[model samples]
Target: MGLPLLMLASGSAALAAPAAAANDETCRPTIESPWVRAAPPGAKSLAAYLVLRNGCGTAVEVVDVESLDFGTPMIHRTVEEGGVSRMRPAGKLVLAPGESLRFEPGGLHLMLMQPLRPLAEGDVARVRLVLADGRRLFAQFPVRRSAP
Candidate 1:
């Protein structure tokens, strides 16, 4: 009887360990230091920057972006061609396990166009990041008067 009890306890412990690991993996990527550049009055669009950290063991892809304050929110990247800078669409951003991606000026960023209303310094905009795995994460980006 004593041996049977010990075996049962050890089996339960082994089962619980896997369950804890699964829980950790389920907690997808995290967004850090999110902010939006404040545009001048009557400007058609603005830029947003942030850092995405993947805490899970598998890779995750950001497929789409949505914002209530802007008509269209899309990922974009800045490229230099013969010293001329141009902006282009970034199809999808994939973050590997334990990796971090930065979206900053002169690099990858979010192009927020057609503001639903005028935005000013210190205002907050809510943006949703849709992952390819069907997980949606919401972030509040504060409007800054200047770039960092």
Candidate 2:
């Protein structure tokens, strides 16, 4: 009985190692030039853009995007079908090693909806990129009228 219990403990320890490694600094993705576009007064929705780069050796998925400043913030991609451009909510985003995904106007972007308050230029918005492995990367995006 003691031998079996010891083996079980050893197996459990091994299983916990990967969960600890999920938050490893080396595996964390990087974000560059994160900024939110200033919206007109009374506007219910706004757009934010950023560049997400994965420098890790393995692929990672950005499971969700969230913010406390807005009621709903989601990842969106602009698509063109039959020469008509439409914006749609982009599902989970997966980044391969050494890949940099851009969120820019007329392309992929973050849809900031239901602003809690009017955000003006020079203000900053706090957002988080939640990874599939339970790691949350927080970012502050400055509000601007144009691309930074």
Candidate 3:
């Protein structure tokens, strides 16, 4: 009924040109196959997982993630300690050269809260990822009933 709480970060606004360029020596992040898992009816929380491919020789740290659909879109990791599983904020996520990080269930994922609306099958959401180097990568996530 109202505007979505999730919105993309503005980190890339200043570096749009360079970020769009391919294979830039400074910093570059290749995002591929991003999608949101299906949620049950009346579900208040959801997770978005994707693969971040680092092209630059140096490592890139994901400083923050912004989404207008959630009250707080943060980077969180599932920690299993003492045989107990809990979710905590991941201050920063790092990616090395040619490295691809997977954000999947039961692991690191984007903790989306207070969805603007229930995610239905075949729905697509736009998300923006901000890298520590001030690069913003835009991505669209398809809402799938299940993930392989």
Candidate 4:
């Protein structure tokens, strides 16, 4: 296979931390507990969950998400309205500085589509987290039957 084309945006690299630490230059974000659910064969897509935090100083905008194993990867969130629930595209979420956002079932998540191969337990999926500043962060999501 060839190298994947990076879909990066020149939106001023971490020019301003979106949610909390807009001015904190000392801010370094982190991704924790990243995991993807095990799917049956022939499954078209999968949902990955994790915790994103920007503790201390500064802010960052997660511009986009991409994966080599999947053709399409998008950040989305589950919303409840009028007693009904649905999934919608979460366009550039901003987390308050010193705050942590949880992406779990029935909440914010990464939708990985068009899997290159079926991922099962013990397998891992690697994804790129693009920040607004044109910087990129790599995350490895282990496949699991359920949240650990």
Candidate 5:
């Protein structure tokens, strides 16, 4: 009985060790040069752009995004269909090993709609991004008057 119990405990610990390591040293994705596109007065919707660089050995995917400034901050991509450009939810943004993804106009971006309050220059918006492995990356995106 004692031998079996010891073996069981050892096996359980072995299984949990990797999971703990994965959580401890997971990928870190940084958002750089984050800015919101300048919107016209009375406009209810805006878009934010940034560059996401993965600084980890393993690849990571951005599965979700959230912000209090917008009704719903969603990952979006612009596509041209039938000579009309439309923006649609990206659902998820995946990055390969040591890869960087850029979000800008006519490309992947954040759709910020129905601003709770007016978003003006110098207003830094707090944003949260959830990775596929349940890790949350945060960034304070500065509200700018134009896209750079």
Candidate 6:
């Protein structure tokens, strides 16, 4: 049997945290400091950020992400071309062994679109990342009033 899928949502003061270990030893990615920006009223989308750390001896690829709070969750990156800033799809993120990747403002992030409901500060959103090795990692991202 496989590990159960985790559902993380916020209503209380304490946020949900992801598991520190994986069911299989070959793949273990630790997620830390997950958070979503508090969207303005009627806003259509928001960005989520976190740190992904590979603790295994091999590389791991994060192929996709899913969330129940939004209609779609896509990996995205902010780019500047000809002095114009734009957002683009980031196909996949590969992490080398013992590597840590940070998703922050003005960099790689998760584009959460078509929110099922409005989000505010202190709200928690549930997100799951799909890996190339067929492993799913769950995380809880808190909605913050400002970027951390």
Better of 3 and 4 by TM-score: 4
Native-to-model Cα distance after best TM-score fit, residue 77 in candidate 1, in Å: 0.4
Task: Kindly report which residue stretches of model 4 are placed more than 4 angstroms away from their true locations once superposed.
Answer: 1-27
Clashing pairs in 1: none
lDDT per residue for candidate 5 within 27-132, as digits (tens), equals 4878888888767767788889999998777778899888877787888999999999999888667898789999998989988878877877777777888888
Winner by lDDT: 2
Model 4: lowest-lDDT 10 consecutive positions:
1-10
**lDDT per residue as tens, model 1, 1-148:** 9999999999999989976775454577998999999888998999999999998888889998999999998999999989999999986688989999999999999999999988899999999888886678899999997664
Better of 2 and 3 by TM-score: 2
Better of 4 and 6 by lDDT: 6
RMSD of each: 4.4, 2.7, 13.6, 12.3, 2.2, 13.4
TM-score, each model? 0.81, 0.85, 0.76, 0.78, 0.85, 0.81
Backbone clashes, candidate 1: 0
The reply for model 5, stretches above 4 Å from the true place, is 1-11
Can you tell me which runs of candidate 6 are displaced by over 4 Å?
Answer: 1-27
User: lDDT value for candidate 2?
Assistant: 0.91
Q: What is the lDDT of residue 37 in candidate 4?
A: 95
Clashes of each: 0, 0, 8, 5, 0, 0
Better of 1 and 3 by TM-score: 1
Tens digits of per-residue lDDT for model 2, 10-43: 9999999987676676668998999999988888
For candidate 3, the per-residue lDDT at 30 reads 82
Whole-model lDDT values for every prediction: 0.89, 0.91, 0.78, 0.83, 0.84, 0.86
What C-alpha lDDT does candidate 4 achieve relative to the native structure?
0.83
Top-down lDDT ranking: 2, 1, 6, 5, 4, 3
Model 3 over residues 14-111: C-alpha lDDT tens digits?
Answer: 46865555446455688788888878988888888888898777778898887766677778999998999999887668887888998888998888
